[model samples]
Each structure stands twice: as C-alpha cells, then as structure tokens.
Target chain A: MRVLGVDPGLTRCGLGVVDGAPGRPLRMAAVGVVRTAADDGVGARLVAIERGIEAWLDEHRPEAVAVERVFSQHNVRTVMGTAQASAVAILCASRRGLPVHLHTPSEVKAAVTGSGRADKAQVGAMVTRLLRLDAPPKPADAADALALAICHIWRGTATGRLQQAVAAHAHPRG
Target chain B: MRVLGVDPGLTRCGLGVVDGAPGRPLRMAAVGVVRTAADDGVGARLVAIERGIEAWLDEHRPEAVAVERVFSQHNVRTVMGTAQASAVAILCASRRGLPVHLHTPSEVKAAVTGSGRADKAQVGAMVTRLLRLDAPPKPADAADALALAICHIWRGTATGRLQQAVAAHAHPRG
Candidate 1:
C-alpha cells in the first residue's frame, strides 16, 4: 500500500508519500509542500490549498493517507488557523476515497524516536536515518510529514501490534 | 465600508458581501458560493476556491472580511475536515491585506437575535428583517455568512461600546 502523510499549516503544508508492503521496506515516493502567501484571505488561500492537494493526488495515487491531528494550543487564533489547516488535509484524503489516519503529535514523536516528548529536530534526525535519506528533509513541515509516514509504516506493520492497538483504542469512533 | 463574510465548508463555501457605509443603507454587493467536488484532491479544490475568492474580491473590493470561528466538536473527523475549509478562508483574506475578523457561533447568533442560543431559522429570519431583504438568505450557509458579517459590523461600531469594553478588558495587554 502507498501511504501519504501530511502536516498542514496556513503558510505551508508538508507532504510525504511512501510505499509499504509486507516484508519490504517502505520506499519513498514523493515529498514536497503546498504554500500560500500570509496576506491572502481565507477563501483565496483555501483555493491554493485545494489545488495543491489535487495536483499531488493526481501525481501519486496513494492508497492510504495519514495526517497529524490538531492539538489544542494556548493561542485561540493560532489554534483556529491550525484547525483549518487540519481540515484541508482531512478533506483532501476523504475526497480521494482514501482512508485517513490521524496521529497526535505525541504519538508521532514517540514513533519517530523512543520518547513521546521528542522535539522536532530529534524526530527529523530519526526520520532521516530510518528513511536512509542523505540529508534531513528541508523545512520542519516536510520532516514532520515524513515522520508521520514513518510512524504509520511502523504502526501498521505486524510488529507494531502494540502501538496500533493503543492508537485504535484512542480512536474508538473515528 | 464594504465587508465580506464567509462560511467555509469542505464542499461549498458560503459568501456574502455588504456595503455598510454611514449614509448608505447596507447594500448586498453579491452573495454566492465557491464549490469543489469531493472527488477532487486538496490542490484542485483549493484552486477552485482561490479562483472563486479572487473573482469575488475583484468584483467587490471589501475593506474588511469576517469569518465564523469553528470550535471543537465531538466528531474529530468532521472537525478536521471543516478546519481545512476555514484555513482557506483565513489565508485568502490575509493575502489581500484585508483586516480579518472572526466571530464565534454564539456571538453571531446573539448579534442577530438578541440571544446566543438562537436557532439557524431564527437567525436567518432576523437577518432578513434587519437587512429588509425580500426573503431569508436562500441557503442556511448564506444566511450564516451574512449573520457573521452583521455581527462584525454591529460589534465594530460605536453602538458596540459595551462589547468593545468587554473586549478591551479581556485583552488588557492589547
């Protein structure tokens, strides 16, 4: 199965795609971003995002999608913005008829590293090493997205039954 | 000043623009929707949204834009999808140098119906009567968008002194 992972943001969206098969290593398919100017209105910015997602979907036909869930933040304004970005990722996945899996920040961090409290840099370093990439992905968003994909690959595997069980329990109804 | 109100959704975004100057009665410059198919990916949907917003902005250069702020919902999946649509609205407004205002559902309800617990029909009825429109805005989303704009106009005016005072107190540092 091909899995696409996304980290959504108002200014930029990080995307990564990987092919996963039983007993085979997850192969990198694509990695990139969709961006819009900070000055655009909500309507216009959405257009840019939708278009970016459509193009990416067309290019790489992923069988499944995983997106980072929106975590609660202290700032209401930022939270609202992040929520909107989260919606875009979900919308994109659903529209394509691909089952979407949402991972919390802590879960992604734990999967990338050994600790749930791992920082972005630590997660990035781990992702680079695991994916056998020459260098860490550029822009924190992309690295995070790649990490999300890696997390899913590991969690979706038979060896990851413990983690998958916990994740499934967390999403009782989703 | 002309202000545009938007209610963003995964498949459709409701929009309404009103010219609210001192002497001029509120004029409905335009009201419509920007739509995208569920089958389309994020990028394609965003393009359609962007084009729609651009057309609206180009036709009616509203000075300010108002959008409804989405709060947490029980359904994580639904909230995630809606968030993307909201981001599109916010980004589009920001890009055009429009001073964006966000209105909570209760705030808009209260502004229109003198009560925060008003139903959609009640809010729609009041909006139609307040604006002296021939009928309630066709779709529920349209009325909601108009209500959002009205809430901003009502809250941003001299008559909204109480609200302004409350806002100031809420954010004393600002």
Candidate 2:
C-alpha cells in the first residue's frame, strides 16, 4: 500500500510518501516540506498550506494519508497552529476519498524506533536505515512524516489481519 | 459594509452577517449555525464547515469576514477544535479575496456592550438592541457571532479612518 504522511505545522509542514505493506521492504517515494511565511496572515498561510498539500496529492497519488495527531497538551502557543495544519492535511486527503489515519507522535516513534520516548536523532537514524537512504531526510519534520507513514502501514495491516481472524473465528470456515 | 462573523466550533459553528457603517444603524443580514455530528471525524467536520461557510458567503456576499480569534490558553481539549474550525472559516473567506479579520472575545464584547468582560447575556442583549431585533439571537454562539461582526465594523471603520487621516497629513492635500 502507498501512503502519504504529514507532520503538520504552520511554519513548515513535512510531507513524505512511502510504498510498503506487511513483510515487504519499505520504499520512500518522496520527501519534502511545505513552508509558509510567518509574517503572513493566518488565513493566507493556511491557503498556501492547502495549495501545497493539494500539489502533493496530485503528484504522489497515495492510497491513504496519515497525519500526526496533535495534542492540545503540547506547547500552549504552538499546539493551535499544529492542529490547524493537521486539519488542512486531513481535509485535503479525505476529501479525495482516500483513507485518513492519525498517529500520535509517540506511536510514530515506537513504530520505527521501538521506543515511544525516542529522541529526534534516534527516529531520524531509524528512518534512514529503514528507507535505505544514504542520509537522513534533511529536516527532522520530514523524517517524522516518514515514520508516521511507516506506523500507519504496519499498524493498519496488523489491525486488518486481526479483524479477519476474529471474523473467521465467529463464523467458522464454510 | 457587510461583514460575516463566524464563531467557530467543531460541533456548532455560529454564523452571522451584519450591514452597517461607523455612524449608521446596524442591520442583521442573517444568523445561523452549521452543526456536525459528534461521531464524525475531525476532517469530515471541517469539510462540512467549509461547505457551510461557502454557502453562507454565496448567499450573503459579505464584503468582509470576521472570525473569533481562538486562543490556545482556552479549554485545553476544546480549543483545538475551535482553532481548526476558525481556520476553515478564514480559509473559505480569504480564498474568495474577502478581507478576513479576527477579533478577540473581549474585543467583541467591548464593542457590543462597552465592557471587555461583559457576560454572554449582556453581549446578547446589546446585539439585539443594536440590530433592532425583537429578541437576542438564539444560541449564545449566534449572538456572539453578531457581536464579532459589529465589532469588526466599528473597529475596522475607525482603523481605516485613522490610516486615511495619517496619509492625508503626510501628503497634505492642496
């Protein structure tokens, strides 16, 4: 399955696409950041971010989109912007009928580094290793985005399998 | 000038349109709420809000849009939704080239009732009095929306005049 992951922020929104599924090697399709001027009005900044996300969707054509779920408990000032940016990402993908999933920061960290409390350097190192890239993605945000996609793919596949198993047990084989 | 005020929330987004100027009576063009089911995902709710705001813009054709500025310091859990909803409102209006202004809750209350800390009922009563309505708009959010519009009109007009005056002084008309 192909998935686009978004590490949402008002100043620099990270975007990464990955193609992978259970027992398959992951491949990085693209990685980039969508930036908006801090001096711009909030509305104009949001519009710019929207356009950027739209361009990514048109180019990558991912089957599903995963966004980092923002917690209000984060930085009191920055959390609002993070939530707003994530909303834009989710809206863009879901409006196109693509499945949208939200993963917490801890979930992404644990999925790749086996530790929810892993530092940025650790997460970046693992993303580089998993994607087989010579170097980590330039910005930490981009690496986080890749990790989000990885988490979604792994978790979603396992959840799907678990559901199938439950269904089979309930009905028995025909 | 005609202005649309949006009191944004995840479940209940209040909308109000008012027509007025600095020295004239205010008229209530319209008032309503856009509601989303509690069970719907955040992205879906945001899309619904965008559509609702678009319809209001199409019908009212307000020259400007005024939205309540969300503060992250507010209720932790609810503030994120409010910020996201406000983003949708701002995006919809600004995309169409309408001037979008954000007024703080205190600013709206002060404009309507001459007090920054005015209670909701006080603000509602003033909205009813200013718009010459028989009753205050139902749902405090709706009244708060009208207050936002009223604040935008009064404050915006004054700001424009101040800027014009400064320009006139600098240029010195013959």
- lDDT tens digits, residue span B27-121, model 1: 67777788789897655665577668778888888888888877654355555445566676676677676878878889999987999999999
Standalone chain B TM-score for every prediction: 0.84, 0.96
Query: What are the clashing pairs of model 2?
Result: none
**Model 2 misses residue A31 by how many Å?**
0.5
Local lDDT at B66 for model 2: 94
lDDT of 1 by residue, A91-160 (tens): 6667566777778888889987989999888988988887789898889899898888877777756445
Top-lDDT structure, candidate number? 2
Q: Which candidate leads in DockQ?
A: 2
Displacement of residue A90 (Cα, Å) in model 2 is 1.3
TM-score of chain A of 2: 0.95
Q: After superposition, how far is residue A65 of candidate 1 from its true place, in Å?
A: 10
